[model samples]
Target: MKQFNQFAARPSAMSRALRKAFVYMTLAGTPALLSTAAYAQAVANDESTSATGVGAGDAALPTVTVNAAGESGQHLQTQSANGALGSRSVLDTPFSITSVTADDLADKQILKLGDVFSNDASVSDNSGGYSAWASYITIRGLPADWQNSFRIDGKPFLGYGITLPYDHFERIDLLKGSSGFMYGFGTPGGLVNYISKKPTDTPVRSVSVGYTSGNIWSEHVDLGGRFGNDQMFGYRLNATHDQGETFNEGYLRRNSVSLALDARLTRDLTWDFQSIWQNSNSDDQTPSIYTANYTGATLPSVISGGNRTLVGPGQHLNTNFQLYQTGLTYRINPDWKANLSYSHSSARRNRNEQTIYLKNAAGDYDNYRSDYLEAHTYDQWQAMVEGNARTGFLEHQLVFGASWQKQVNDYTVNSIYQLSGTGNIYAQNTNAYYSNTALRTYHAGEITQQALFASDTLKFSERWSVLAGLRYNQFEQNAFGIGGNRTSTYSKNATTPTVALMFKPEPNTTVYTSYVESLEQGGTPSLGQDNYGQQLKPLTSKQYEVGAKTSQQGWSATAALFRIERAAEYTLGNALVQDGQSIYQGLELGGAYRPAPQWQLGASLMLLDATYKKGSTFTGNRVAGAPKNMATAQIAYLVPQVAGLKLMADAKYTGNTMLRAANDIELSSYTLFNLGASYTTRLGKYDTTFRAAVNNLLDKRYWQYQYENYIKPGDPRTFSVSAKLDF
Candidate 1:
């Protein structure tokens, strides 16, 4: 037997105790997770921009907006989906996509990405306590993995974990249904496209400082200006800093930098260059080992048995996400434009995890190598030439685009054994295990994606409008990983047909119904030839939604009911289990009403029913972590006569959900409330605002989502106050 301490005899008592701790941690975490800060904001200026200066104190407030269409379409004139896309409305293309505009974000006080996604019932955060720092966002109960991609200002911002800073985003766009036709490689449920804040031709500068509970502090500065002698060039810059402690002893600090530049090449040609630098320190997971209640009865909030300690022992974690992207759009004629863009990112993560103390009750004395660190780089470039023509014969739109993307990742780690109780002198130099070489070696993959799509809008009569479209895509990826280098190329072809009929009973009300088809490549016979290679087949889905949107008297409300079905859903298992299948059916409602010029009320609510067919382990049972209902509502009032006085209160609710395979183990429903008020004034050119707010007002004790083996309660009631100043 190997002796840990050469000078002393091996103590039997210490050995037994350490063994117990290891089993406890591995068995499943108990109810000992840290707190989830109630929630975790914007750039760009047009006449539409509203800057909420930052402030410092103990108040929690989010710079928020709650719009359905999102920031991209806010400046556009058309309200309906087809008109916004011009003549690009095709049979298989998606026209029902939704965006949360920056203007709407300005009024709503939502901070965290969870707050933004709350609008779609299909979207849910399953952070579960284990990795409270990172929420496993599931859409229609589908995991966000290779199929889902995230971009900042249309540029890829991939990282090892899902921790993000919402303050830097202008708005979030949630495209419903399969989008492989346009978005390439994502889940059938949808994709989240984040638009960055762009520079404005108009000049404006402001700064805000604020704080939250647990002594959290943050500051933000936004600047915009016109460039050049002619002022054709414009620039926008935004910067933010945040520091705070979470549920336990862990801390969170994040800062991000974003800049946008625009240049008018000519009367019709425009070029924009965007860049972002973001760095954050976050925990990947902090879950407790829990034993489910066998009887299905209510269990205690605190676990009677399990490990209780701070996460990561005494290690520090740091991650950096940086990106550079430039896009060029040229108008060839009055009705046509050419779009070209390319982006690249250098994403690196460093983590340290282990036992830190002997007397401390927060950690295990294990020397196991659990800490993970890696670097991933992806370069993607795309170009598309599109045109819109309106003639006597017909009004049509055409688009031709081709894209190439490459990704490479390198993983490194060290494994060693150490003493259980002693805090120091555990392990020394030993063989290091580099994950990059052991598992998926550092490899590069090249993917070529090409597509051509066209559509036409036929206005046979004033009372009736019909639109149609078709698109084709060719995709290929050549991959090389740690197992060795392998090239897998395959060809896939798909055609999508769409039909839409809209009847405008009145000038302000429009009701429309449509169905669209989306296709995805599933297998590559070239790669699957070997055990490590995968011969992918195609996966597809169908989306059907009927919605009615009406804008009248400064109020807009839209509601849609949709049913989406996919042939198969990958389950949790060794081989990416594809046996199980499911259908996600849900309803989405969003609206904003200006009861008075100063008072605005907007709400987004979605109720869904996700059912999975018979499969290996999940046959007939509700999928784990799938919540049945989710909702959000916000009301904000700005005193028109009072310059910059605002009061806002928001409420959100997530219904009960199952936690494990038995369906007997589950987490009850919970509701949270948020309230805040802001008073703003101008001092010369400097703008300042004082704000106050409360999070988890009710202090309800509930379980956010947890596995059958463990239980962790939600956060308690907390209060905060803050102030922001801008110049």
Candidate 2:
């Protein structure tokens, strides 16, 4: 274990506190003053450009306009953000990426982040349902790190025990494989970025009402417009409220509000501000089953006790979140630009979970309860410069920038845990033995990350190009005891690199190969291990990928082959250590085709082979929770006879999954079907739309594999309907 006797090498408590305050003040108050000065400079000069600014990029390229056609057509996105490298056409980018727009969410009536990409073969809902800790997903056969895998508006946020309303976001982007050179630190699995809706150039107003299975009801309002001379000021606002019983008999109430404002002081200078708030409460959530004690090769059947809500009274999860941000963009000239931004976000959570421990394959279990209270705050600042230059025989698009981020965490010392009672899966229970109570909280720890990155795309000809990027990162973690004294400190730094080569056979075709490396926070030893509570060194991951993409004649297709090798951590002879490696190799194929003017078809398939390599009992065994094959297909038909009516159906298939490192137990394969329809028409001078969907139409009972000791029940059949009006 590492020692913690270096207090003299660190800053004093008073200095640390002052530094934190100073950073807060700078982030909160500096943007406005800086923008004022830029505005004055802008007014003094009449030379300006009308081009929009690219966000969070070292190279300030022209912004790509996202329109309704991109949202409602073809089921394919043309452009996606490549981290600090800016946005590129999907066909031209060397990495695999995907985006889901607001229109898709509304059509499917999706409420949670996991459900947004349920049809993608490369993604899986690991938790199967909402969690008091966090909603989790698995990408490329690895679970994403909930603490560090999420971002908002190109900035970092703590993704613990909070769910933001989807209505506030215009789009969600996913970057697959190692992103160390683009993003400072993250898991190799992937990254999820939520792009909030911004102010519009035209006037807009809309209202919507929706209902889901079990009588859940929701109302939403959206408003946006510009005002002042030459429409120099713009604003967009969204508000929503929902309350009712869930399909599994759980009750929930949620409220959220988001606002975006921008001031175009001059054609070449722009400033923007954003604020978001959300509060949600859930009760009687469906309980997850613990299979550690069953010891049976054959687990309990899903139909035996699946879809059962074991939660009783006094059990609930409540969360609150808030975020504020400000940024300024200045177009130095047509060939170059500069950007600066700062943001702060916080989350608070209080939750109690009802847990069940399985005793046998016949559905008997012991009931228990667990409680948690935690708060997290984060602050980040970023600056970038981007430009285009040509020298002799090559043209270069260059970007360079730096960023700093810090997070402070507070948690209860020891959460309350109590045994409620014992019961059988076939029986029923609805009594509470304990009530929610307050617990003492203490400062847990803090983490800081800093990065400097640069990238260049060298275009040698219209048909060939190369991209090279590098990032230098430093990470620090400090642990504190309950008495407010620092117990341990860890600091590490590394430089990651990425390189790619591309070839374009045609205007709409691209073939590429890329290699990248990443570093991620390591795992801590669990109970019963010889080194329990000891933190390990950072783990490194590497990936190699080759892919091809094309879009032509109302159709698009993509194919990729990749391999990832990540360091593994497991118990060896009752001692936890980082050794060996987990290797994952996979092939992915996806496409969309508009066979005719009224018909659209889409499909995706993934084949993965994952294994653990080491001289141990787990050697050569299939990785736990990884599936070998996954497939999805969907079709939509626009009725030629009806003016604006569309019908759609989709199906997904998942192969058997390993449930333990020993590979002695496995989950059965399952397939699901969904159906939906939408109609658009004019209602009393208002453009109106009505949508309906039936998820899990076949009502199949299945178990979602999470890890070695936990399994969750798939949601039951559910129905949803909604209506929206635009004015």
Q: Candidate 1's error at 173, in angstroms?
A: 2.1
Candidate 1 lDDT tens digits, 361-461: 22222323334555777687777666766568555555555666665545442322233232211222122222222322244444455555555555544
| Residue 201 shift from truth in candidate 1, angstroms | 2.0
Global CA lDDT computed for model 1: 0.53
Question: Considering summed lDDT, which 10 consecutive residues are worst modelled in model 1?
Answer: 32-41
lDDT, candidate 2, at 21: 41
Q: For model 2, name the residue pairs that clash.
A: 59-386
- lDDT for predicted candidate 2 compared with the true structure: 0.75
Question: How would you encode candidate 2's per-residue C-alpha lDDT over 222-315 as one tens digit per residue?
Answer: 9999999999999999998776667766677788999999999998999999989999987767766766566678877674222344666667
* Candidate 2, superposed: residue stretches over 4 Å from native: 1-77, 303-308, 430-436, 524-536, 570-577, 615-617
User: Hey, what RMSD does candidate 2 come out at?
Assistant: 14.4
